[model samples]
Target: MTLQAGTDTALAATDHGAASSNDYRTGTAARLAGLPVETLRVWERRYNISETARSARGQRLYSDAQVRRLSLIKQLVDEGHAVGSLARLEDEQLRTLLPAATPAAPAPARPVKVALIGDALVRRLAGGGRELFALDIVGACASLEAAGRLRTSGAEVLLIELAELSDAALAPIAALRAQLGAAAVVLYRFGASATLARLRADGCIVAHGPADLSQLVLLCESARPGAPQFADAASIALAPPRFDDASLAALASMPSDLICECPRHLAELLMMLNSFERYSGECANRTPADAVVHRDLGVAAGQARMLLEAALERLARAEGLALPVADGAA
Candidate 1:
């Protein structure tokens, strides 16, 4: 993400012979604009959202103004505006259409108590604690050992900074969540599609960057003790759909003997169902325009998983194979 900010005309002058502010390559522009490179290209070709210039070798470059315009478009799109309607507007006109930026709301009377779990996160909070005044920092820890102490530190939220999206990184977070019981767990990490999906599946509210303070605050504010865990609708929309009847039928049709031999397979299916239920609940909390598609998909997955689990359990019993007692069973 280039930090340079100026109109295209000014940038053009700089390109010619003046002091040069860094111009962004297409990839960098995409990051700054919060759009995929392909989406950016489509907007340009279909909507002419921004005009691009080519370098000597034909690499596309975006001026800061163009990146800003793309960012505005993305913000509006997320807010439920149609791209076709917004595409033709000039930058200044689009700005007028956007809701005015408001100051962050004052911290709630009883702010969510947060526990910090990374050196970088600790430093970041220390530097800009004001932006997160809505959260009360009850404890700070750099390692799992220190994080363990948070259980008794009166912290109601665990905010962990993760370096990657791998299972290894997630394992400790899972442990923390389990240990803390009702405490809400939030993860901060920069990840690709796969990682983000996994994080969401695990019921973690994820922020892609440290600078996403507002998003982080919203997640914290939404956290409630003993509340059902759920995936964000945006995250669910990005996940591959899992409720196809054919797929569920194939899974159910597996030989009873084979399924019984690996009883953990049934257990894993139950876990998947539990995860999807949380996602379904989360989808329900979102606005209809944002949540409808994902909410319907989540409900479908939950229904399919539930039926499949029942069918498998019947098959196990019919095969005279005793399944392990399920959690919450008397």
Candidate 2:
């Protein structure tokens, strides 16, 4: 077997094989399906989420149908559905099982100031899309270049629609946003992954487009900043699992000289916190709109983990129990 670039790429040659535009290799499928490659492989081996077609060399390939199924499964999983329960579901069955769409958020105390761009989008909103969010429309334009008159709007948010995106167009977009002295919510139907990731990293709000009216409203609301302290995700390097499941079980069950089983209780708490922290991190990657919320959860979990680990260490020492290698997180 040959290996290069990364494990997934090495498994698929550039020859394209019998793959059509709708067929995707492991990495693309994982990204589109919002799953890690390894996790997808495991699901294939265990749940066989659905039958997948492999390339000539035996490398797995996911058809467009399979990718869609995985995306649905991912959404359901995030909503608390167990993977095992969903794995056996057919695509249409999964769709029917999905809950009703997320309701629009309640309007804020004071409507946010926003400017609209794009004639069709503006017209659509004019017809009623603007009602989805608590927003004050200060200006309207049909294109980015035509947005010059908007400089006087004193808008806090700029909602622009892009039929397509190009890297060269980014600089002008950035400069225009700077001139308006406002944050932006960019809606696009298509763009290069790297370009989109770059835009996101620079604090610009982005969403798939042409978004439905409610989605547009959500994007506009996202431009509004949250509390100052939580503006960015807190930086905390969480250590790997401190103890395996078996180790934890053993620690919890072993007879202790202590008056109460405080250590056992603490161990349980630590396990819960650790699981939640990792889940938050996964959600951050899978859900673009709620990335901030997940990041916040991950940080809070890390803090809790460190404190609990310290308590666990002290109690373990008091009982003269051998502990795992120090993670130094406490």
Candidate 3:
């Protein structure tokens, strides 16, 4: 059997007979369901779920009938069903039961494992309602790629947390988009900005409010079976970035008197300055390299340099002298 990205590909393949008739040896069932081997044992021993015949060596071998039952059990569990309750369910009962729990409210779509990247906002919004595989940005992307290759839980949409996105995080996001194409790419930003606009231009659907986001996801899921679509929900006005007092205090306390202005220190400072300068030039040129910093740093032209200067001024005032980088030498 061959594997490929997207569930449709697998469903379209000619190996359905082979997959359905495969023997349910211990490892085979677990491999297909992507569940733990120990889970299989627990369901059988503790829950009386899977009844298997043992060989002379005492190894359990399940029938194809058992494998199909176990596969549904895994899907249900992954969708957040209580394992104990599901283990008691027969195959017919489980199928009737899954549709209600799988969808957010109405019709149950096919089981598509989505990898949520960034903050816990997506979890809170969905309220653990769907079969979501939550992973950090890095892990989520890796899982998406793997699922695409395996044709099991291929990512149909990405729920990205812009507030949590760092300068380093953009590369993986870009890679995912390049790999997945103009699929449903949902980005949640702190507020509306040129940065969000840029992301939208690069084929992202931007949502600034949580309410709007929840609705947008519903729409995207609805559109999945019908047509490829895009939305300019970026028109939704949003508030500016706000920091709490504790966060402000923490930012204030970061630069210390230990920041040496020696030649070595100055050299490092100059390198950083030069790097930022080069980054700015590349950004102006609209090269792919510019996106490296654009997504990771979220730095804007004109204002960013001035902001850096202002920060150094505050640091110098706190330290009671000119900082090495602030001086012309750096």
Candidate 4:
């Protein structure tokens, strides 16, 4: 779920907790179904996935049935179903598309082959003087270029560390993954929330980089499929704001040639995100666990802000409106 959706629904969570036990607003439905709100909107716009109902107040709402249906579709899409194909399935037919659940057989024991990146993480592991669990370090190197020289192609895991992460880091990292042929990756980052969301969305396992050796190893272990990725469990948290209050206000008030409320609405959404981001930071001060949770929330919020900001920018450009002063992530 996007930070917006997560915060919106999380604030309004009900007691009933199952796949299909509650009516939900759009954001809540998206959160429960594990789909981004934009993706949900796209599916509805392009495929008519559900004939959603409206509340008495004229707000769109999703039934428990619709939420469950979307969840099933999301799982299928993650497993490689084309969205268009799944959109055409009837509710009953869609249920049938899900694989039958059976008892999970114990996985065969084998040492995981892992390639390491980053000198600090490597030294941290080595400096700890610990024997890792079922892990075989195939190649340990300081940079992706050096790893290429190590010839650890087809390694099962890629464990990397970065002092700071940005959206730009993904491309090079992806290239390294292709070269190394790593099936799973664990990233330790003291990085931007916006970057973390994009990374998580692309299916990378991310963790706070300051963890001790044992914790880092466990994070790598969680990267393997079905091992309960903690980063995934963390989910993307509340996001930080990209634009400040004044900037959003100016953008919201700008005179425009376009005949729509979208620009203003986008600004309003961003203001809400900004408020929540600040709220999350304040929440972080209470305890260590809160710090982690709020940090994730801030990351989710930052990512969400970036998405809305792009939309606002496109509209501003299309309308030839004067833009507000730009700002960086908070």
Q: Write the per-residue lDDT of candidate 2 for residues 1-330, one digit (tens) a residue.
A: 222211111111332221444556565566557777688878778888878887777777777677777888887887788899899877777777677884222221334567777666665665543233245565676676666545434567878788887787688678878888788888888899877876776678878888886676667777865513443555656566566545666677777777888888887787788788878888635345457767888888877887888788888787888765433422
TM-score of 2: 0.43
Rate residue 306 of model 1 by lDDT: 60
Q: Specify the poorest-scoring 10-residue window by lDDT in model 2.
A: 3-12
The candidate 4 region of ten consecutive residues with least summed lDDT is 5-14
- The TM-score obtained by model 3 is 0.29
Model 2: clashing residue pairs? none
Top lDDT hit: 2
RMSD of each: 17.3, 19.2, 16.7, 21.2
lDDT of each: 0.58, 0.67, 0.46, 0.64
- Model 3, residue 232: distance off in Å is 16
Indicate the residue-level lDDT of 249 in model 4.
88
- Runs with alpha carbons beyond 4 Å of true place in candidate 3: 1-113, 122-127, 130-152, 164-171, 180-184, 212-216, 222-330
Q: Residues 1-330, candidate 4: write the lDDT tens digits.
A: 112211111111211111122445565566567777789889988998887787665556777677778887888888778999999888777667667882222222333556667766665554322234235555567754455555553457788777777766788777776776665454554677767766665667777767765676676777755564336425655344557888888878877667788888899998998788678767734445446667777677767777887787788788777666656744
Q: List ranges where model 2 is wrong by over 4 Å.
A: 1-108, 225-330
TM per candidate:
0.36, 0.43, 0.29, 0.36
Q: For model 3, what is the alpha-carbon lDDT of residue 150?
A: 27
Compared to the true structure, candidate 4 yields what TM-score?
A: 0.36
Lowest summed lDDT window (length 10), candidate 1: 1-10
